[model samples]
Target chain A: MKQFLHSGFVRLAIVVVMAYVIVSLCGLREHVSILSGVDESGTMHLVFGLIYILSYAASLVLAPALFLAAIIETTLSKVNVLSRKGQEGRRLGCSELRERQRLRAPEHAP
Target chain B: MKSRLCISAIALILAIAIWLPLLHLFFRPDIGDLGLEKGVSRIADQLAAHHLQIWTNPDLRNRELAQMRQLNPEWDFMSRTFLVMALASIALRDESRIPQCLETIDLVIENTLLIEQEDGFQDFLLGYGYADNWKVQPPKSIFVDGEISLMIGARRMVADRADYQHLMAERIGNMVAQMTLSPVLSAESYPDECWVFCNTIALAAIRLGDVLDHSNHSEFLREWVETAKLHLVEPQSGLLISAYAVDGTPLPNGPGPEGTSIWMACHMLQVVDGAFAQDQYQRAKAQLGRSLLGFGYSREWPRAFAGVMDIDSGPIVPFVEASASASGLALLGAAGFSDKKYLRQLMTSLNIAGFPTRKNGTLCYQASNPVGDAVLLYALVQGPLWEKAK
Candidate 1:
């Protein structure tokens, strides 16, 4: 659903999973020499190396960042919701009390 | 969908930004962590054992050697030299291993000389080595002669072999006579190409020959050093030029560090002249050495010089100018001079970047071949040989 796709946590999870898949599929970690754009075969493995490096960076760096961002976003949104509920509750309570007081004022009036 | 994707992208970028700076923290190597000690390091023992295993077992040795020979036969020959030197140093360190080391030394020497005799000196050189006819009457490559002599001299330094003693004398005699005859006191390792690396190894071999035979070539070494100081130095970088013509003309790629070349030059120079060797190491350190996020490496050329990438330089990483060959060999220079800081940094880099693989009690870098591993082994155990020679 659009709702699920819009969820920040779900999006981050997708990215992390995608990166993990690509990283595993490419066998990037085993080819660390790709960082220098050269492999043991003495040819430029730059494209593969770039993919490996990027996937690695994403896995280590971006995944954690997305998790942190989702945590902060969820926490802040929850706090906002809770505070709004508390204010509404207080206002409703005050209005209800006023109504009772008004109704009782007539009873207790001279 | 677009908004969600944008959010995800932003989060990813921020995460990557945080991770990139701290990534090296996971790889930062302490000197202790690298197994570096006062004399021979633990990694040295492991690497030496791996090489010993290869040499002792023909199946493993042939497979490894065939891989290198497929690329360059010169690497196969050089691997023999480096392995012999490493084993000699290890023997000097541990008396119990002397017999085993000597056996391997004789085996390597026998095989190398056999190859040279059957295939000729051109067998030990790149095809370009014989690209043109030699200016000198009879073509003898200092590259083959020099490394072979050092191999022989190192063998004698550990324990005298009368056969190798004669071979060492003969090789040094030829080198000395060749230098004496040349106008600039330089001899060719190829047709007209002379490498400072081969010449330095020849000088070190001559010095070791003196230690063994009690015949001093002190004056000749002194004159050669003087000539090199005046002509062989790259004025801009103050490091010795890598290659030159027989007439002492600096080659087009002359002034570059050429990673594999400089480290060996620095190592061999230690025996030829300690003070000068230290000076070369320092200049090279200032120019080519780099440490980023605790990982140390060496550049193929100083920042001031624009150089080409060759087989010797290997592939150079763009921003840092880190050469695979140079960075690996930087260990030799760092260890040779007792430069603990750089040594530790370089070791950390090797672990982080060099793709170390150990299986069944033997170790080798997956990213490097047999020749690279042999050179690394020599760098690790190199000190003992120099100490004994001194």
Candidate 2:
């Protein structure tokens, strides 16, 4: 049932997360040039040159939420009743096949 | 079923740990932007008040100094600088606190000048600095002179009193003339030695020049930094040399993002040139600022530069050169840039490891060098002076 979480929404969520991180980090380069000045107090302030901090910040807020939603979907899908039944069936069938193999094996009583 | 339950439990814990800090990041804090304030930020306020106790109470100050002296004398000098810078900010933030902040500043200015006069300025340096003569016949140390002048200069800039302005003009004139006489745009601080600290001081002096109407000095300050970029600063790290001779010669050192130092350098350069200041801060931030399990840690140097640890870096622990100087100074840089997230992480780290011991209603971080605390104070009280100057 967890496999059901591998759906379109989950994929889209992951892609959004990656894209958000990429663009947010890329935007900081411009800030590098702006902050390199001697301040009035004569002290230097070093920011990572993330002039568009709000944008990286926006991504920082959104990307993780999307990823969390994907994880929840994956978890919820793993808990379905039919999926549980299907797993039970597979476990029983495998057990029975093993028992039959044990019974059918022609071995001298060593 | 049991295995799945255990796995899920572990995953849930990890996820919560990861998301909690990021979650805090979402909520825009309604508080002030971390300038000097009264009771608004208990954290920054407490930090300043603790340093205040040193000047206000001689007994407490002596006890603290006695303990720190066993470590390094540089720390002792740094404590004065940091506290002076912090009080200057506090004065700006709380007008009511001016009388108190000014008292501390006055005492510090007096003591600093007294120390310089008594020790001949070289007393604060490492023994090696005194060894062998500097190549230039008339030895000089712009580093000592520059910072001392700036400290006094900043105090006066915030709340002008007649005493400080006169001293600043004298220091500013001397620094400007020294730059002009040297053809390479480099002044000999110690014989022929040039240092980033001194150069930054000159920049600060020039900035004060602009504020005080020292018009003729601008061109000299501008040209010196340009020539300096060619002679002292490395093209690779974009960080300046740890030390250099007069003629741009590398003295066994290439480049170091030396711990704590890089952050201080960034903060200092912020005074020298805005464009250069911006570049230094961003470079240091990218190279050092890191996050692990949602916690931030800053390194001493970037990958491009390799260096051995020393008194300045202050003990790089394994796997990462977490130079106390660089990381502590990074706090100033991060705060200066207004990178709230990094600042938050750094503050959190300070709270966790900096060993805050609240004594007599004042807050100070234990395990931090005096210089480290000074840098922190400068970070806290930085904005108003800059804004006021403009």
Candidate 3:
């Protein structure tokens, strides 16, 4: 499950799905309120309902794109090149910087 | 558990995709039954739901007004014009609310005329006003004259304060004379050039004149049509041009509905000439109006032409082809001719997207201009004023 979550493809799909849920719920909540007579058009429930449905339908068309985004995000991270390239540049670390400074300070003190 | 979670997630997403648009259906107003009754209409109720904010709150009104003016000052001006006219029509529609509506309308008119007379009509000009002479002489605009005249007429039609009647007459007379003296029954906002839209402005004046019994002005109205046939009519669309040279000569291009002028033209035509008004309304409807999923909106241009967004169309929405200017002015067409079908859809479109608020018996649309809402209000109450006056 953790591995699945870490997969970029699943991550992308999740993001899309999450957005879809949030917007739909927000729109639905507004519709529910209006339907309950929080607005002037006490009977305009039908109109708001259609708008919500159309928006929901439009969101579904993005499913394939979500799948593709997931694949790409995962694929882009795993491409590999040689260990030889790693030796071409000096690998520095916090300990290496401290060691070099200590050596220089002691030599200067002597 | 994972499968159930996945299933629910998919279901939830699908549910939203299907439902948000359905919300529009819920707000869809009945087209036939929304008749502007002796009391406030469901449509007026929808409009006022938004408009009440303008009167009740200063900061909110100014902020919204500023945002629209950033795009089109004419909107700022037309918003007032439309709201004042709408309130007047509402007064006639509902005698009980006349006092409250009157106070708001009076405030709007007071602000409008004061600004125009104080800053000169040039105050409403786009940044382009000083960039080039958009008009002839020092600087004059027939569009401003016509709107102000209608605003004054609308005010007087309701309240009958002594001064507005005279103001209406004087303004109407100037527009009539302006139409007469132009070589082709058209007046210019620029040097000797004429616009069908401006002619429509003049038509509004002519209609006001009709109410006032300037039967003599019939010839003026006739000449305007004949001249438009000769010069302004686009061969392909048969729709009028956005502008032209004064003497029956077509300008280089065809009509553009991205401004207040064209919609106002359609409305003014209804008042000045009945058949012509009907023709204009149908042409405009074909060119711009659309209904989808029971909601109605209008495009800034017909399919035959493509144009960019401007001050009038206000932040064009994609795919559905709705323009702020076209949709707002569309109220005139829907109301002027009593096209119940269009009015029904127009109301639905407005309620869903125009963000209406109703408070303490006043209505307003937040995303709409004062003028645009007023036009909607006018649409609701239009019939008798034109009828009683005629």
Candidate 4:
């Protein structure tokens, strides 16, 4: 779980989601009317609006994408590890069979 | 670790590749069901509910109007006009809502007239509107006069109002007299500055007035169109210029063939001269309309005459040059002309970027203000009113 959290994709996804939640909770969505040239409050409002919109777009598109990518990466790596283990197990089984055949040959040599 | 990093990078790229292309699908509305032809669309209904609530609740309406008036007083006035027009269209579409729509329309008209009476016409104009003396005497803004006229005329179209008859006639008369003073037969929305947007709207109002009162303004309307074609059109694009002088010469430094003005101009012109309006719509569409990957938008100016952004254009998206205001009005133009494919694409873009919000059975776009939402509503429910006027 700690290693999973260490993944760059997962960390970025967490950041995006956290930022979006903070922006949403701050009620900055109302400031987004600035895009339509409706807000005249000040640069502060514009800044807030831009932040809110960026966070929103990130949350909607980027966060999901990052999470999906992380999940896929984890799944692929897991499959790789399992396949390697399977190959090692098969190799060990073959060596054991060879050793058993060697023992049987010695016994049949007489 | 390195392999995991590479896998993550590739996975990220692949995920983006899959997601970006599919994003619009989630926001894509079924265009056919939007009621572009007849009946009230679901979107229209929800948008109307929001506006209707605003009108009924004075506190809410005041807050919205105050927010708009801070940026541009014109938006406040235009919001009322667009809302009234939308309500009238909705009323026409759904017979059962006639009473509710008429009540709201009357409320809007009454409030507008009261403001105009108390504060004067400049109440609805920008601060620069007072900078230069109006060329016409008694200092009336056709921007104010024309839109108010259209609002009244639209209301009367749904059902006759004896009180508004004289009001409509007076507005039409003022507009006609003032417009005739210009070489292009246009009136100024600002001092010495005539807008195609305002004049076309006034012409539409006059046409509607003629239909309602049996007044004859056909010759004047025809002459205006001819003059516009001869003097007001941008040669490069063959679309109408956005602003000009009272003498009908296009302002050298002014906007040329702007989407913000042309789309609504085409719509208003539909009632005056169908062929000319159709030509303008096609030309405007060819010049200003743009779509990419199923998302549609409009540029404020054509490529040959890429103008600076202004209040009318709203914010222009860099490189692509998408004007928020123009795109909103383009919806009206596309829907009015029944350009289904463009309309669908535009709606897709709208649904994605407009950030539609719904609460208590009402819908409004978080990215839009009262005027923008009203414009969207008018776009959705535009056809029946225009058809009735015709």
The lDDT leader among the candidates is 4
Per-residue error for B342 in candidate 1, Å, reads 1.5
Evaluate candidate 2 and give its CAPRI docking class based on DockQ.
incorrect
Worst 10 residues of 3 chain B by lDDT: B252-261
What does candidate 3's lDDT look like per residue over A1-110, in tens digits? 45335754456566666665775666552452332111333355656645554454444445444454434433332221233244433454556888899889977894
DockQ list for all candidates? 0.20, 0.04, 0.02, 0.49
Q: What would the DockQ be for model 2? A: 0.04
Docking class of 3: incorrect
Better candidate by lDDT, 3 or 4: 4
lDDT of 1 by residue, A28-89 (tens): 65665543322345444556656666675566556666665665445455566688799999
Local distance difference test values of all predictions, in order: 0.79, 0.63, 0.64, 0.89
Clashes of each: 0, 24, 60, 0
Off by over 4 Å in 1: A1-110, B1-18, B30-40, B253-255
Q: Which regions of candidate 2 fall more than 4 Å away from where they truly are?
A: A1-110, B1-33, B36-40, B180-184, B187-192, B213-215
TM-scores of chain A in all candidate models: 0.65, 0.37, 0.34, 0.74
B347 Cα displacement, candidate 1 (Å): 1.9
Error in Å for residue B278 of model 4? 1.9
Write candidate 2's Cα lDDT for B1-390 as tens digits. 675555445544554556656654433323353543433266667777777766778897776665554455556766776677777777777788888888889898898789788977666655555756765444556766676777786787667777777787787777766666555555555556665655665676567657755455556657766876776666676776655666656545424445465566666666566787788777777777875544456876677777766655656758755655666777788877777777766666555445455666776654564456667767766767656543
Candidate 2 residue A106 C-alpha distance from true site, Å: 25
lDDT of 2 at B192: 61
